[model samples]
Target: MHLPPKQGAAFDPLSEAFARDPYPAYAALRATAQPVYYAPFDIWLLSRYADVQAAALNPLSLRSLDHLMSADEMAEERRAQNWHDMPFHARFVQFSMLNADGEVHQRLRKLVFREFTPGQIERLKTGVATYVGGLFDRLGGPFDFIEDLAAHVPGLAIGRFLGVPDEDCPQLRGWSDDIVQYFDIDRTDARKALAERTTKTFYDYLTDLSKHRRRHPKDDLISRLIARWDTGELSEDEYISTCMLILMAGHGSTIDALGNGLTALLRFPDQRLMLSADRTLMPTAIQEMFRYDAPLPFFHRYASEDMEINGWELPKSTKIGLLYGSANRDPEAFADADTFDITRTPNRHLAFAAGPHFCLGNHLARLNMEAVFSQLLDRYPRIEPVTEPVFKPGLSLRGPKSLPIAVR
Candidate 1:
């Protein structure tokens, strides 16, 4: 009997060192020239840009294995993953527009797809700008960029879009953080309890909010979803799940992107100076930032059928982890993958994973980054980091934990 070499042995995602710099490990994984089998998770990790892209574009590469697994099998798998006990997390977070495939994915996606279209998201630009501007107006001295600024914008922007009260946005942020933390590799019992508790609380809040929308429909995502539910187009679980998905997906990810972008600018002052000189590079710079440090880096897919990828044959039900952060920094994909160039052309980065499940809130996330970075450049002539930024330690998410910046 032969054993599968643990190629992922060096990849310790839970370590603080990895959080500070995972690119080195990612590079090593990609150098192996084949998918690395991580025995701990029983999954093959795809690190190269081409491999990740292939897996993402392959229809057989599914987000959820429920389609192929039987009820008992799924239950057993969930139990193995410690994902069985949480009823609310299983209902809402486990099965969502994000995890569904085929017709089911399309149907759930279309329900709120229009709300995220460029034009629709564009409408909220003015509001986001106003909100971010107000935040800057109140800050007169040095502050933690993550907690003080980046943390505030995404929640309010997404909250307003969902018709969540501005006052409740802070609480929503807390709920989102707690729930999202459990999605990472470290699923401790404490984290699991927090995730379930927050999920239930969030579900309850959305339940009450949906009731209000039912009584008096408003011009918000929740109201629109409620209308769909009333028309038999959506189930009660789907409605709540969709709302929770939107808030959770958009809130923390955007905040991380904002912080990562700022940290990039501060670290590569030359790039920041170039952006200041040529404001037109903001869009490309935003893309570069996402590529440089993708907030949501590790996403998994299960093979629905046998598939050949990067010279390796994967059997049915095989789990493949797509390292988006690593792909973005792959040298073959970008001329100078490691360099943070604001003006890099033809940057087809997978910061937002490609194919059917490409991030729905991508446009909104970009708009938020543009508004915040643009304001930072316009409002303050000199911005400097007060201390070394410490990134949130996780494989699932990437961003500085806090970034204290002095602005004038």
Candidate 2:
């Protein structure tokens, strides 16, 4: 019973309309087929649950973005970006593990995986409560939740988890912000250049800091990573790259999810009230937010060999965009999948992504959301939006740049 995958609408992931609200477009895509050949992005997009999972869990598939390229595409992008003139940007491309797989990813992920366990995240709950409590206490009026609360709180938690000096947490966030520009699918050469400069400075500073930590070991992730580096379990580049990646990945999505989650709660009053009445629902409620709207839109995989998805033959090295945002909302997977129901049982959405590269910081993110939103319910009797939330100008990530919420 193999029916042909339906033809999907034209998708422009970077278009302005897509950024503010992409679900409608995503819904259309999901209705069509399991995987659609989106010519605009030049990648096959998998919107169905089964297709997305297959792409995610298949070990033969490649996680590295570099795998999506042919040597010609690389040469063209190099000419387009003038990256060779920028040493640090070039070095970043070479060393980053985001696009690497196999032993490199394993070694890089292993160095810090022990300290990044779910149990460790559970332990950070107390610290999350403390940091968020003080932050909420300081808010006295109409506040930009994204800037004032969502952004800073995650950094504070990450700072504590990584053993960064409390004072340097804000500094770490600055670097996280800059490095995230690379994730922006629509970033210009100018912005990419700025991000590269920031990352170079960021890399140099952290490398020096890691050296200091190696000599004077501390109770932190970097200290532990340095220990492995000393024992020859990790390379210098891999160690430095992991430190940078963890901070960006750990801090960025959590901030977006927090902003997105709080906004969702405000929009859906019934669900909000339900959570407020029964605190037991916080876990499921957070899961709902993730499923309803993933903060990040897509994850990519490279075809290891010729493959068929939804009847489309993808040649080796073909770039595939696993549309996690769309997949989570597929009605085939969940009843009334578009609704924001906090009490969703067995809500196994691919918000953290799927398979080996599933988010390493998911537990920490959940802990932070629980800490902040629970306190938020008590802190504000009602939250009214001053304006429609303004999202950052990109399709790759979703979150308000500023969400002015009047607390009464």
lDDT of 2 by residue, 24-66 (tens): 9888777763446463544667788778877888776787545
Which candidate achieves the best TM-score against the true structure? 1
Clash-forming residue pairs, model 2: 64-99
Residue 274 in model 2: lDDT: 91
lDDT of 1 by residue, 1-408 (tens): 112466545678878889899999899887864545573666778889998999899888999988889999999998888898999998999989998999989999998889999998888999999999999888879999999899999888899888998888888789999999998877889999999999999998888887877898888888888889989999988888899999999889998999999999998999998998899999999999999999999899998988878667787898889999999999999998999999999889999999999999999899999999999999887899999998888789998889999988
Off by over 4 Å in 2: 1-9, 65-86
Give the C-alpha miss distance for residue 201 in model 1, angstroms.
Answer: 0.6
lDDT of each: 0.89, 0.79
Q: After superposition, how far is residue 68 of candidate 2 from its true place, in Å?
A: 8.1
Error of 2 at 204 (Å): 2.2
**Model 1 bad stretches (over 4 Å):** 1-4
What's model 1's lDDT at 3? Answer: 20
